[model samples]
Target: MTFSKDEQPKNIPESNTTDNVAVPKNFLIPFLLLSLKQWNMHGYKLMQVLLDLGFTTIDSSNVYRTLRQLEKDHYIKSNWEQGEEGPAKRIYSITEEGEAFLKTCHSSFLQYQQMLQTFFSIYTNSLFPISNFTDKND
Candidate 1:
């Protein structure tokens, strides 16, 4: 089935790549911290939990780097634990500071969520005609 441009619905937002939908930026922090808040885990387990949490385009290097930064900032703490069959693995857990930071993140993200909802509502609830678009010549 083909959709005609002229037949487009008024309330539908203009088409754009799905990539622009929700690009997670600075979200890796809360995700990692939040997980650690629940339980301690090794880097491997943390990475898997991030994948399970819907971070599809994440880089392993980036995750490790971020973890290092968080550790340096004293937001999180880590220690080595001997794995059953392999070498010791570094297990990470949220520090008191990390939990405090996570709470702040929750407040900030809640505001952002409201802003995003208001933004989408404009596209989904009302008609904004193409004719209203201002020309550069104006």
Candidate 2:
């Protein structure tokens, strides 16, 4: 299933936030799927959860698009439910494949965290080179 250009969400917020780190696009699907594992929700609710989790600038369109993609990729599944007070809602749930994918994403995220830690260490040491810690023993 291909999402046409017009189908994509428009006018994404320019700034996510000045405080919290913005969620990377690659991590979006994993995050959404993980949340679905916790509880099934419709697109709007999913976007709300993401926004509440420090992603203040997330676009609903992007969230919906990601959901569609996840469904196409077999990482997630959805069912429409008729609402008592409003239109039907499409509820999303994580599939077994999604669970496996979430595990992979978690593993990769951990590795990425370790790499960032290593980089920070190198940066910190570079800024303040302790004489005793240098390769050349004085």
Candidate 3:
């Protein structure tokens, strides 16, 4: 059900659903950084490594674009590696900044994981009560 602006409840906040995001923004960043931290590799290999790690629904274009952005943001660095039997490949490695960012992301995700656990526990437990959630506006 869609709500028109005029018909929407004043007390309810605007919804920013997952639909607004093609994929969770940077959901793949830490994985990419962590992969680089472990072993520097070219884009194709990196994606393969990620797939091996059980990450699905990955878009190649988005991965390349994100890699370029990471390079621009100084989180990662790439250099062209001349292949013996193939064309040169751009090797990606995590910078110190990227490693630091990955650590931060790990910590934040742990906390988020806890919150999700709590949510699921409450959702699955019959002891849960809808009235436990009180509107701040009240």
Top-TM-score structure, candidate number: 1
Candidate 3, which segments miss by more than 4 Å at Cα?
A: 1-23, 127-138
lDDT order, best first, reads 1, 3, 2
lDDT of 3 at 37: 91
| Number of the candidate with higher lDDT, 1 or 2 | 1
C-alpha displacement of 7 in model 1, angstroms?
25
How much lDDT does candidate 3 score? 0.85
Cα-based lDDT at residue 53, candidate 2: 64
C-alpha RMSD by candidate, in order: 9.9, 9.6, 8.1
TM-score of 3: 0.72
Better of 1 and 2 by TM-score: 1
Pairwise lDDT winner, candidates 2 and 3: 3
Where's the lowest-lDDT run of ten residues in candidate 2?
8-17
Model 2 lDDT vs. the true structure? 0.84
Q: Pairs clashing in candidate 3?
A: none
Clash count of each predicted structure:
0, 0, 0
Global lDDT scores for all candidate models: 0.86, 0.84, 0.85
Query: How do the residues 21-134 of candidate 3 rate in per-residue lDDT, one tens digit apiece?
Result: 334556789889989999999999988987787665668998999999999999999999998988999999999999889999999999999999998997766465666667
lDDT of 1 by residue, 32-116 (tens): 9999999999887898988888876667898899999999999999999997898999999999999999999999999999999
